[model samples]
Target chain A: MLPLIHRFIDQAADQNPHHPAFIFQERSLSYGDLVLQANRLANVLIDLGVRPLDRVGIYLTKSMEIPVAIYGILKAGAAYVPIDPSAPLDRVDYMIRDCGITHLVSSPVRKRALHQLLERDTGLKAIVGVDRELLETDPLTCLSWEEVLQADSEDPPVKVTDQDLAYIMYTSGSTGHPKGMMHTHASGASYAHYSAMTYGVGPADRLGNHSHLHFDMSTFEFLTGPSRGATTIIIPNEAMLFPTRLADLVQNEKLTFWYSVPLALIQMLALEDIGNRDWSSLRWILFGGEPFPPKYLRLLMDMLPGARFSNVYGPAEVNQCTYFHVTRESVQGDQPVPLGRVWEGAESRILNGEGQPVRPGEPGELLIRSSTMMQGYWGKPDLTEKSIHIEEPLPGFTKRFYRTGDLVSIDEKGLLAFHGRKDRQVKIRGYRIELDELENIASAFDEVQEAAVVVAEQAGGDKELVAVLLLKEGRNLDSAEARKRFADHLSAYAVPKRIYFPATLPRTSSGKIDRRQLAQEYAETA
Target chain B: MEITKMPDKSQIESEIQTHFQGEGIELERDEDLFSSGQVDSMALMQAVAHLEATYGLKIPPGDLVPENFRTVEVMADYVIQRR
Candidate 1:
């Protein structure tokens, strides 16, 4: 059987050879052209001694090179590691060394960074930069993107078993190190196939590539788009943060499909001139990086009367496990929006803290079992075991299930509804937050004598972390000064929503600040 | 407090209603904005900015949270509440 991603690209090239497969800034690559380029890239990799199962890191931003690099890696029968360029420098070094990556195909800018980093750790085989001149001099030295594509071979990679790893993606590490989750060809294919069917992707669809490749939401855009012969348009970087640019692309390119976190959708809805933008071309909007506000759902429906909005539920470990179809009737009713039905080849259930299945309407942890389940964290076997567990006395218990950590419930209709996270890990604008990280920063503040961070529920059921601090004996700092200090050490989102100066922290008899009590106070005052 | 009708009150109420129409409960001019739990801090930002731009008014950055946007009525009052 053909590998899942290749099967789609091959079919698309054969059926619609002249159709535009990818549209970057001033360049448009047709299905046939993309195939040829990927084939040449595969030939270059083979000549450089890259073999089946060898991991190749693609370190770059969202660009034309990303798609070519993905296709080339798979074409060489090698799995790819999509390194986020914007991640902290230490993270980039850790992923390269941890994955045992041999070659990194990246842009010239990244090549420079790699050069500086690899000098400190020279075990890397090569730093392949995207320049024609760079590729000619050395099989072991840095090669350019053009040099790799100059080969004439049209042959595809040799077939491999379904269980062979396809890609390795790293997510936020709870244990002080980023964890790389490995996915096999078949499992990763499951995500591409299910997304195509679920989102109704086809030749006529124009899909927007919005999410960074590091994020799972971009999988469908980069993987399924080419396989389905749909046109995948990469939104320019500056356009990502602004809604006007997205509106322009949708109306200009006639983009029919969109996938991003709900926060992006809300930003689009808040546009004062949103009414002027013609988003009629958008047919499907699949969103879920975090729990979306139901209010944003209604605003979207009112704005785009024809778009089919869906709530996608899944963690990075399992690509996409469930979806809730957005309907007007559901919005009018009092019930919360469902995360929808389980996608193809997936099974899901809500389990209580004790691991037993919860009764319908009872909140519990959401668990997923599916073909798309990751192999495991790249190196941390202990964490892998804890996250992927087996239920005793159950057959196929060895088959792993991923714990999503999200508290949820199942309705009578079997639709999943999100409640909250069981841990202090809150999603701030789609980026995962470990409250402990904030606490670490708060404790580091020189002026702060003591601190506690708690998620407070605000109006419309949204949660925000507010930091309550007790100053040192004689020193007092205002909220502005404390926030500035937090910004220096953490990302802006990690900074608490509000900083409160309390005369004395409310503590339990044991002397631990009563965080629960603080939350109650915020709820009352908020 | 009862709100006096302002030129921007109708525009603010209309936008808030449209902004929050399908998400959940509808909004009235005198509804508790967000601090009192009528809307949310996250969703309220959208409503605040909508009113500011639609009417050419600016809500200070220091006054960003729900305390400032507690009600469509308070917001309407804020049109005059500003220093």
Candidate 2:
């Protein structure tokens, strides 16, 4: 059986107790110290009655405490559900209740928000505040960070198996509510093993953690580093906004492995003169989440002559299934970078509408079969059945394949190139956004009789969400008020940039909302 | 190289509006472009490239903070100061 992810940390700590494990905000924690903290937090979790496979919500920002909470929850034999602390209160409440989360680890700064969320009568039983003083007025049983740290620093000997869930990452769903992707210890361990081997990450490498806890890329950034005994550097949120500052951090931290969405790298390249910076320590630069423009990719290759680049692709449901190494010859073309070959231990197939594998050079949906594939969406059996299909009965065993909904084609060179999405899903800056989700939220408003959302490509090739709302007869809605209402229901990226109240929304012959017509109309008018 | 006059606030706003072309949404001078979902990471990169080419101002990595590009007014101020 595969060992739990925390076992890697334990092994590293035992071997190199004094080696730096993580560096955050100028503070460094050695492997021994980090594991002790995690062990103590695990004892705290056990004392709170957390059992194996139980879901615990992690609602803290990207900080030193995040790694501790994550490893602690894993050590306690419970699956950690990361709730983006910046998410709306209603969304957070929905996830907490949906996942049946019994314990939550958050910072004290969110005390008011947590209290308000708990008022909704979620299944949350205990709240562990990291660095906030517990008050009598707190709605739930709150434990201070100091108290949790005082627990015995011994590993909790919970009977955790490889099949046990390690984490549940929630992503945007087409049906308005976010769906939690369930990943097991086996799947996560496979990813860690393959990733460490593919990227050549080792103890000498300093891996940069740029992605948020809620994002799938963070799995590779956080877990693979520990798996290889590498030092993980958590880039502060504020540093991300300033490309120059982020570059300085990379230089100062001596990051050897850097991974993030292509958008962030593009921003850094545009704002910073990386050609002049000391990037000798930067070895592997990995990007995914969206397609990178060829021009920018070429420029990036030219700028970083010493670094090797890889275009990694996969959904949250399957972590890092395929990777395309950017070669000097590959970057010469005007075409977008190829999705490349499937990663080791993962199977891929391009099937047409009839579910048969398509011929080479024919566009079809990509299906993935791998140990790293998510077990299923949490409490969403119907969605799970629809998204994952079991192959027809074979002699030995049936194979389950996940329909990725991504349209791709294998070129003559045997490289898979992305065409487009087969569904209404769109990615904006590495965030998987479902257009119907925005439409559903808009339709929920009282004044909105009908709503349609479309992705509009700006002059700079950036996709922006545009909403067309048809109000009920004799009723009106203010755009500002609508935007304010959207903030309460969705994340900032999900909010449409422009809201239009048209007299009637165009429909197709089948009476479905015609998004193409709406897009053309909006474009013509603008 | 000859020094040229820096663009005004309205000109920069006009250029940004033309670049983004948000159908009918009017951007305020002090509006937070990022939080408002108007300026994403890619859009910000495009805006930086456009500003450099249009205004002939070298926007170093240090000048790419929120304070410099949070709004057209601030962006124009940054350009004028650099010029």
TM-scores of all candidate predictions against the true structure:
0.77, 0.87
Instruction: Judge the docking of candidate 1 as incorrect, acceptable, medium or high.
Output: incorrect
lDDT of 2 by residue, A1-526 (tens): 5578889889899889999999998799999999999999899989989999999999876678888998999999999999876567788889988999989988765655665676677877788864334444344577888888899998989998889999999999898889999999998988898888888889999999998889899998678899988999988765666677787788888899889988778877876367667778889999999888888988877777899999999888989788889998887878788999888879888999998989999999999999888999999999999999777567878899899999999877778989999899999778899988888899999999889999876556567788999999999898867876776767666778778998878889999989998887765332
* Model 2 ranges off by over 4 Å: A130-135, A524-526, B1-83
lDDT of 2: 0.82
lDDT of 1 at A285: 85
lDDT value, residue A403 of candidate 2: 93
lDDT of 1 by residue, A319-388 (tens): 8899888888878755567888877779776789888999988999988889878988888888788887
Query: Stretches of candidate 1 above 4 Å error?
Result: A131-140, A156-159, A333-335, A391-399, A437-506, A509-513, A517-526, B1-83
Each prediction's whole-model lDDT (CA):
0.74, 0.82
The pairs that clash in candidate 2 are none
